[model samples]
Target: SNLETETEKLIQIVLIGQPELDQLLKKNELRQLRQRITISWELLPLNRDETRGYIQHRINVALGKGRVQFSRSAVELIYKYSHGIPRMINVLADRSLLIAYTMNTKKITPKIVRPAVKDVGGLNPLTTWIDSLWKTILPGFLALSILLFGANYLMLPDFNKKNVEEKDLNLIIKENPIIPKNLIISNSQAPIIDLPQSGNLALEKMKPVTPSHQAYTPDDSLTTKLLNPRRIPSTKPLIIS
Candidate 1:
């Protein structure tokens, strides 16, 4: 004011400060100064995409072709917490990078940024709520998912084994039309036979059958059917003892 009064040439005065300066000048005591101000321009905060580009630009200038990078999630968190203020962005970004460095990682993520935000303090209620939500909810959800996956993985083999056993049982029943009532198929035991004495004559006429990995001694009823000297496939031979 003194300089302008002395010069009498309408000197221009520029006030550059944080947004708080606007509220400061709006106070009752500063009404005269506020009214006398010739012009006022407030710098708007950067938006989400602009904040990303700004951060990337700074990183590129500092690192050149370095491998260090910020994940999109981390950038989003930074934008949320800083509300696109450049100085706050710098603070959060720097802290996040430092946190990542301590953890021996070149990439900054929301996990790293969360801790950095806490360490820097001055978080708004919404940001704090989000931080708490992630800290508590995300881990529990992931753990549940992993547990469910593990349970499903563990149960799959048993289900497949049961199906295979059933299929094997059905195939055995289909291939051998006459199965003894006492014949039992189990994992630990092979098929058993209860032969009757009525088909001894037919058994003697039957040729000595080839051995196989799966050999079943048939009932007297099956021995009667073998009396007809028909061609049997070698792969699916009926063994009788």
Candidate 2:
């Protein structure tokens, strides 16, 4: 390949394909074709702001003017549905223009953009709802599933396991004490005692009693102070309300 004649002209070839198809062409298969190629480039779509500028530039070039009128909201809608791709933007912009023209709109507006989006079969609401549902529902469902799985794994018996002996099928059950419903705290036939005429047992109990005489003892350890006790201070008798 390096011993080419001076009269022969060297030609280079460029190949392009989608990201998915790139792996189909192996370096070994294209060795001869790509022998002279020293560089390769990968291009990505523009972002929302960049897409807006891109659409405006295309519109300006097509109309032979510095600017083409597009409402802010309309531009945003276009960017949202187009996903900031140049070719997708062109397609949506063309469709939107057609819709605007038919609807007698001088400049593209959000109202025009909506119908245009719907007409061209834009994003599906059901699919969007499903996506949102997956984001919100799936995680919570999975968490609950995980918790249940862990609990079952920890608490429940494994049916497939062979560790348990078939001969010992009876499991030990705990027995609780049984209480009789008819049991009573006291004997039913027990006689009731009558209250005193005063009907105040606490008052009767609190009443001070007269001091009785203590037996005489000649013990030196027992002083007269011990034999004769100090007088207790009198308190008002309690009156039941």
Query: Any runs in candidate 2 off by more than 4 Å, and if so which?
Result: 1-38, 64-67, 122-241
In model 2, how many backbone clashes occur? 0
- Candidate 2 lDDT over 183-234, as tens digits, reads 4234334343433444234335554455467544444444444434454433
lDDT of 2 at 155: 95
lDDT agreement with native, every candidate = 0.80, 0.67
lDDT score, candidate 2, position 42 = 65
- What TM-score should be assigned to candidate 2? 0.44
- Per-residue alpha-carbon lDDT of candidate 1 for residues 124-219, written as tens digits (9 for 90 to 100): 623557788999999999999999999999876665666777677767877897966445333343334444444457677767565787576667
Report the lDDT of model 1 for residue 126.
34
- The TM-score values for the models, in the order shown, are 0.44, 0.44
**Which 10-residue span in candidate 2 carries the lowest summed lDDT?**
168-177
